[model samples]
Target: MYSQSHFVKALELLILLVVYLAYGSSYRSSSLYLYVTISIWFLVFCWLFAPFVFNPSCFEWHKTVDDWIDWWKWMGNRGGIDLAPEQSWEAWWMSEHEHLKNATIHSLLLEFILSLRFLIYQYGIVYHLHVVHGNKSFMVYALSWLVIAIARVTKGCFIGEREVCHEASNCVPHPQGHRLSCPHRFTVPSVRCF
Candidate 1:
C-alpha cells in the first residue's frame, strides 16, 4: 500500500497535470506539452536525487529548523492558555534564535531553487496563454497564481509543518491562538511525537 505522503504527492502531481491539460489546446500545444513534461520531470528528479546531489546533513538541518518552529508553537499553546506573556516571549525568542542558527547555506540554496520554480510556474502560465489560446482576457488567473506562490513561500518559511496549521493564527503568535486550533479537530490521543 502506498503511504499517505506518497498518495498526497501523487495527487498533487496529478492536479498540476490536470490543470496543464484543462487549459486546453490554447495552453497545451506540442512545445507547451514538452516544457510542462520537462518541468515535472525535473521536479521529480530533484526529489529523487536530493540525497545524492545535495547534502543530507543540510536537508536534515532544514527539517530540524522546520520542526523547531512547530515545537515552539506547541510549547506556546500546550497549557490551553493563549499568549501568556512569558510564553509569547519564549516562543518568539526560541523561534528566532533557532531560525538564525539553522538557516544554513544549503537551506538558502534550496530556497533559491524554489524561487526559480515559482518563476517557472509564472512564465509557464504566460507562455501557455500566449501560444495556445492567445486570449489575455484572464489576467486574474496570473494574479491568482502569484498570490498562491507568495502564500506558499510565506507558509513554508513561517508556518512550519504545514500539515498542522491551516491559518496564520494557529501557527503565528496571537492573543487568541486557542480559538484557531485545527479546525478538523480529529484527535489522535496516542500518537507518538518524534
Candidate 2:
C-alpha cells in the first residue's frame, strides 16, 4: 500500500506530467526537431533511472574514481567506523537499490524533485510560446527547443542526477571500510513528447 506522502507525491507528478504534455502539444513543432526532443527526453529518463536498474556501473561510474574527499575520510577514519554489525550483501544491496530508486524518482516522485525546475520550465515556457503568444516562427521554435535542451542536460544530467549519485556513493563504505561495489546501467525506446 502506498503511504500518504507517496500518494501525494504521485498526484503532484501526474499533474505536472499532464501540464507539460499539454504545453508541448499546444503548437505543432517541426517534425524533425520534435523527434529530436523526444529522443533527448528518453535519454533524460534513462539517465535518471539507470543506476537502480544496474549496479550503478553506468551513471554511478564516478564512484569508482578515487576522490580526495573519500580517500581522506577513509584514511583518517573519520566516519569510517560503524559499530553496528555490517549489513549482509543482499540486505545492503536491497537498501541501496531502494534508496537510489527513491532519490532518482521514487521511481516517479521524490527523485523527480531534482527535475522539478525543468518540468516547470517546460510547461511554462512551452505554454507561453505555443499557446499564450502563439509563436509559430521557425526561429521561435528553434529558440524554445534550445532552452529545453539546455535545461534538460544541465538539470537532469548534472544537478538532479548528481544528488542521487552522491547518495548512492555514500552507501559504498558504510558499516565497514571495504567498499561495496555495484556494477552497470542500461537503457531504450521512445518517440513522442511533442
Candidate 3:
C-alpha cells in the first residue's frame, strides 16, 4: 500500500499536471498566465500548509509530545496551572522521546520549505516581468515583494507562528526566543530534543 507522503506527492504532481496540460498551450504566452499559476499555487497554500503544520497525527509527534504532557498532568498538577519540576521533566522527556526528534525536525523542515511561497512567488513575478514584459521595473517588483515579505514575517511571528513554534518547540530551537508563543509546556532548555 502507498504511504501518506506518496499520496501527497502524487496529488501535488497531479494538480500541477492537470493545470499545466489544461492551460499550458493556451496561456503559454499570455500576460494572464501568471493568474492561472497563482490560482493553483494559492490552492497549495490553502490546502497543504495548515494540515501539515497543525495536524499532529500526520507526523505522530503528538504521541511523543503527549506522552510527556500526560505524565505531567497525571502527577496532580493542573493542566494550565503548572509545569512542575521543569528541569527534570525536560530531561526525562528528552531521554524517552529522543528517537522521535527526527520526525519533528522533518515536519518542521517540510513546513519551512512549503511556506517559502513568498520567495517563490516573487521570483515568479520577476521572471514573468523580465522575460515577458521586459520593462525596467525590476526594482519596483523587488521592493514590492520585499515589503510583502516583511509583512509576512511580522504576521508569522505575531499571528500563526505560535502554533507552529509550539509544534516544533521540543525538536527545534527558535531564534525568536519565547516571544513566539511557544508555551513552556512544550519547550525545554535544550537546543535539540536529544
Candidate 4:
C-alpha cells in the first residue's frame, strides 16, 4: 500500500539509521557507546515521534507563524503590512502539521549526521594544529580552535533558545523593533561587536 513517496522516505530513514548505528558502535568504551546509542535514539524519537505525539496540529500552526514572523522580524519589521496576510486557520493548521512531520525526519538525518561529521573534522583539525605542530604553530593553531569553538558554542546556544521559543509560543515582542528581538539577548552582553 506504500506510495512512491512513502517508499523513498522510508529508504532514506533506513539508510540514515544504519549509518548512525555503524558510527555509534565503533566507539570502544561501554559508557561512550551507551551515550551514543541513547543520543541517537533520542534524536530519532524527536525527528519521528515528536510531530505526532506532541500536538501535531498546534505545533504546525505555531511553526508556520514562527517561520513567517521570524523572516518578517529579520527584515527590520518594516514590512509588517505585507506580512499580515490573513490565512485560513484550518488549511494553515494541516499544512503546518505536515511540514513539521517532514521537518522532524529531515532534521534528524541532516543535523545529526552533519554535526557528527563537523565534530570529527574539528577534532582532526585540533590534533593537527596542536599535537602535530611545535611551539609557535601550536599556540597559534590552539588559539584559532579556541575562538572557533567559542563562536560555535555561542551560536548553538542562541539557536537552541530561539527554537525553544518557537515551540513554546511565548516569544517576546520587542518594542524597539523586530531586529531588537534577536536571539543575541541570550548571549553575553559584553561581547557586542558594535
Candidate 5:
C-alpha cells in the first residue's frame, strides 16, 4: 500500500503530466520543437514518479559533491550519524539508505517545482517564438533553443545543490553551522521569479 505522501506526490506528477499533454496538443500546429519539449518534460515527470511507483524502498543513495576535480572518499560521505540498530553491516547500510531515500524524495519534490517553471518557459517561450508571432527566422530558433538549454542545465544544478544541502544540514556535526549547511534561498523556486 502506498503511503499518503506517495499518493500526494503521484497525484502532483499526474496533474503536471496532464497539463503538459493538454497544452502541447492544443497549441498551434504540431510543431516538432513543442512536442519534443513536452516529451522531454513528460519523461522528467515519469522519472520523478518511477521511484515511488516501482520500488519505493530501493532508491540508491546519491550525494552531491562540491568539488568534482579534487574528489576524495570523504567527498561521498556526508558525516551523518545513522542511528539504526547495529545488528550487522547490512543494517548500517539500510539505515543510511533509508535516510538518503527520504531526503531524495524531498529534494525531488523541490526540483519538480522548479521544473514547473521551466515547463512554462519551455512551452510559452517556444510557442511565442515559433507560432504566435509566426517569425520562423533562424535567429528565433537559435534563441529559443538557447533559453531552453540554459533552463534545463540551471535546473539540474539547483537540484544537485539542494540534495547536497539536505545531506549536509542533516549531518551529525551539522557541518559549518546551520546557516552554511541549510539549502540556500534558491531552493525555493518562487524566489527565482524575481
Candidate 6:
C-alpha cells in the first residue's frame, strides 16, 4: 500500500508528465508552451520541496525539535534558560533523528538532480526553436521557461547550502560550547557518488 506521501508524489509526477506531453511539443503555441513549462517547473518544485515539508520524517523532526522547545519553555518558566541544556537537547535530537537528517539530505540531492534535468530539457527546447526553427519571438518566450528552470536550480542549490548550514550549526562554538557536526556533508558530488 502506498502511503499518502507516496501517492501524492506519484500524482504530481503524473501531472507533470501529462503537461509535458500535451503542451511541451507545441512550440508554435508560445503562450501555451510557456505556461505548460512554467507549470511543470513549479510542479517539480513542489515534488522536491514538498516532501521536506510534509514527509513523515519531517513531522518526527518537528516533534523532536519541539522537545527542545519544550525544554526551553521549561527553562523560561524557571527564569533564564541556560545554553547548556539547549546544546544537550540539540545533541540528543541529532542522535535520535538520523533518519530525518538522511531523508533531508537525500531529498535535497534528488531536487538538485531533477532540477538539472528540467533545465537541460528547457535548454534543448530553446536551442531547437532558436537554431532550427529561427523563431525569434518564440525563442524569447521559451527563454522565459529556461530562466525559470535556472532559477529553480539556483534555488535548489541555495536550499542545499542552507541545509548544510543547518546540519553544521551544532558545531559552531556557542556560549555553552557544544561541538557537534555531522561528518557527512551533503555536497553535490556526494549525490553523484551515491
Task: Output the number of the TM-score-best candidate.
Answer: 1
Q: Which stretches of candidate 3 lie over 4 Å from their true place?
A: 1-15, 26-122, 129-133, 159-194
lDDT of each: 0.54, 0.48, 0.54, 0.52, 0.52, 0.54
Show model 5 residue runs off by greater than 4 Å: 1-132, 166-179, 182-194
- lDDT (C-alpha) at residue 148 in model 4: 84
Per-residue lDDT of model 1, residues 150-187, tens digit only: 77777564444333443322343225433223334532
TM-score (all chains, Cα) for each model: 0.31, 0.23, 0.27, 0.25, 0.25, 0.23
Q: Is 5 or 6 the stronger prediction by lDDT?
A: 6
Q: In candidate 3, where is summed lDDT lowest over 10 consecutive residues?
A: 78-87
**2 or 3, greater by lDDT:** 3
Pairs of colliding residues, candidate 6 = none
- Candidate 2 collision pairs: 57-184, 105-108
Cα lDDT of model 4 by residue, 35-131, tens digit: 8667765665555555456666645887878867864554443222123323333233344345446577777677578558555645544553344
For model 2, give the 10-residue run with minimal summed lDDT. Answer: 185-194
C-alpha displacement of 1 in model 5, angstroms?
11
lDDT of 2 by residue, 163-182 (tens): 34344534332234223333
Residues 1-194 of candidate 5 have per-residue lDDT tens digits of 23234554556556655555656456546687577766766665665676556764444343223323224433344333443333333344445456546577778787678668656755655564345477657676678779778887787664454455545544222343333323343222111311
| Candidate 6 residue lDDT tens string, 1-194 | 13235555656566656646654575746777678666866766676666567656656767779866876864454211233434444344334444555577778787678669556655555655354466657667567778788877876764454355455533332243232234454222211111
- lDDT score for residue 140 of model 2: 64
Candidate 1: segments with Cα more than 4 A from true spot: 1-4, 24-101, 130-194
Query: Mind giving the per-residue lDDT tens digits that candidate 3 earns over 1-194?
Result: 13244446556655654646553575678868778666766665655565556756757777768866866655544222123334344344344444556678778788678768546645655564344366556676677778888876775654344345445544444486533333455653422211
lDDT of 1: 0.54
